[model samples]
Target chain A: AQTVTQSQPEMSVQEAETVTLSCTYDTSENNYYLFWYKQPPSRQMILVIRQEAYKQQNATENRFSVNFQKAAKSFSLKISDSQLGDTAMYFCAFMKRGGAQKLVFGQGTRLTINP
Target chain B: SQTIHQWPATLVQPVGSPLSLECTVEGTSNPNLYWYRQAAGRGLQLLFYSVGIGQISSEVPQNLSASRPQDRQFILSSKKLLLSDSGFYLCAWGVGGGEQYFGPGTRLTVT
Candidate 1:
């Protein structure tokens, strides 16, 4: 069984400020994938970014990036030049490379961008 | 491009009533489908997943059941609803070893 943990339950930051959301997971599988998803007030789940365990380089998508430490079993999300729209509930997810493609998610972190 | 759809955008049902949430995908064939529930202020919990028609895998034991009647249609159902079942339900579609795309989701309120 795999479990993802998001230590921070809630976070608030000023608009345009950078913020990092921490995430850690417990897994025995060697090959897997990590993902960060954002759910805005509209209640739509959107994929922010993803990182493969085999890859040493981190994944970056415009303003969002990840610091993936495979040995430490940690995958953190960084939002640079954050905007008000970035205010949302962020979740970290884990999935094995193959099989049923089931995703195990963390409890989530509620982020608010203040103006 | 692939897209997923889930409906009645919002649902209000009384306890002991039945449930039937439908999900469909467009622009993809034989794609993997999944059902997830998100509790208030919580992350997503994967309830069921199907790799093909008539193949359903349940991740948790609960009052719900899922069925894939067609290649692009997936349904989540329950004979009787419970208060604990009230939450946002999300439907997603994905190909092999790729990221899954989510629908707008259904907000279910069991009163």
Candidate 2:
């Protein structure tokens, strides 16, 4: 069994500042994928970024990036130049290489960007 | 472009009532489909997933059940709903080892 953990229940950041949401997972599989998803007030899950276990280099998508430490099983999401629109419930997810592509998600962190 | 849809946007039902939530995908074939539930202020819990038509796999042992009647359509159902079943139901589709695209989600309330 695999599990994802988001230690922070809630987070706040001033507009134009930077914020980092921490995430960690437990999995025995050597090959897997990590993802960050954002859900706004609309309750729609949006993909933020992704990192493959084999890739030593972290993944970056514009203002959203991930710090993936495979050995420690840590995958943290960093938001640069945060904006009001970035306020949402952020979830960290894990997916194994094969099978149905089922995702294991964290509890989620409610992020608020203050203007 | 691929798209996923779940309905009816929101639903309210009393305890012991039957449930049927529909989900469909467009612009994709043989893609993996999934059903997830999010309780109030909680993380998304994967309920079921399918790799192809008529091949369904359940992740959790719960009162809920899922079926894939068509290649692009997945349905979640329960003969009798429980108050614990109240939550936001999400449908998603994805390819092998790729990111899953989520639907708008359906808020289910069981009183």
Candidate 3:
């Protein structure tokens, strides 16, 4: 079985400041994928970004990027120039390369961006 | 483009009542569907997943069951609801091994 851990339960930052959310997973499978999802006050889950385990380069989506260390089994999300809209609950998810396409998610980190 | 829909937007059901939540996908065929539950201030817990029609895989053993009657339709049900079932229910669809796209989700309150 695979497990994802988010050590930080909550985080707060000022608008335009950068923040990083830490995530680690315990998995025996070498080939897999990692993802970051954001859930705003509307309660809608939105995909922020994803990183393929085979890719050595990290994934960057505009203001959001990830630091994926496959050897260390750690994948962290970095939000640059954070906006008030970025204030939401962030979750780190793990998925195997194939099969049922099940996503195992971490405990989630509640992030608040203040002005 | 692919889209997923889940309804009703919000539901308030009493305990011992039956549950029937529907999820449908558009613009995709033979996609994998999943059902997840989110408790208060918690992450998602996968309840069931289906790769194809009439194929359902349960990840958790609880008072819930899932069915895929059609290629683009998935349903989650329970014979009798419990207080523990009060939470947000999310429906998602994906193709291959890519990231799954989520629906608007259903807020279920078991009173």
Please state the Cα-based DockQ of model 1 relative to the true two-chain complex.
Answer: 0.84
Tens digits of per-residue lDDT for model 2, B2-78: 88889999999999999999999999899899999999999999999999888999989999999999999999999
TM-score of each model, paired residue for residue = 0.98, 0.98, 0.98
lDDT of 3 at A59: 99
- Label model 1 with its docking quality class: high
Runs of candidate 3 with Cα error greater than 4 angstroms are none
**Alpha-carbon lDDT, every model:** 0.95, 0.94, 0.96
List the candidate 2 regions with Cα displacement exceeding 4 Å: none
Model 1 Cα lDDT, one tens digit per residue, A6-63: 9999999999999999999999999999999998999888999999999999999999
- Give the Å shift of residue B103 in candidate 3: 0.7
- Of all native A–B interface contacts, model 3 reproduces a fraction of 0.80
Q: Give Cα distance to truth, residue B81, candidate 2, Å.
A: 0.9
Question: How well is each residue in A36-73 modelled by candidate 3, as lDDT tens digits?
Answer: 99999999999999999999999999999999999899
TM-scores of chain A across the candidates, in order, are 0.99, 0.99, 0.99
- Cα deviation at A16, candidate 2, in Å, is 0.2
**Which of the CAPRI classes, incorrect, acceptable, medium or high, describes model 2?**
high
Query: What are the candidates' individual DockQ scores?
Result: 0.84, 0.89, 0.89
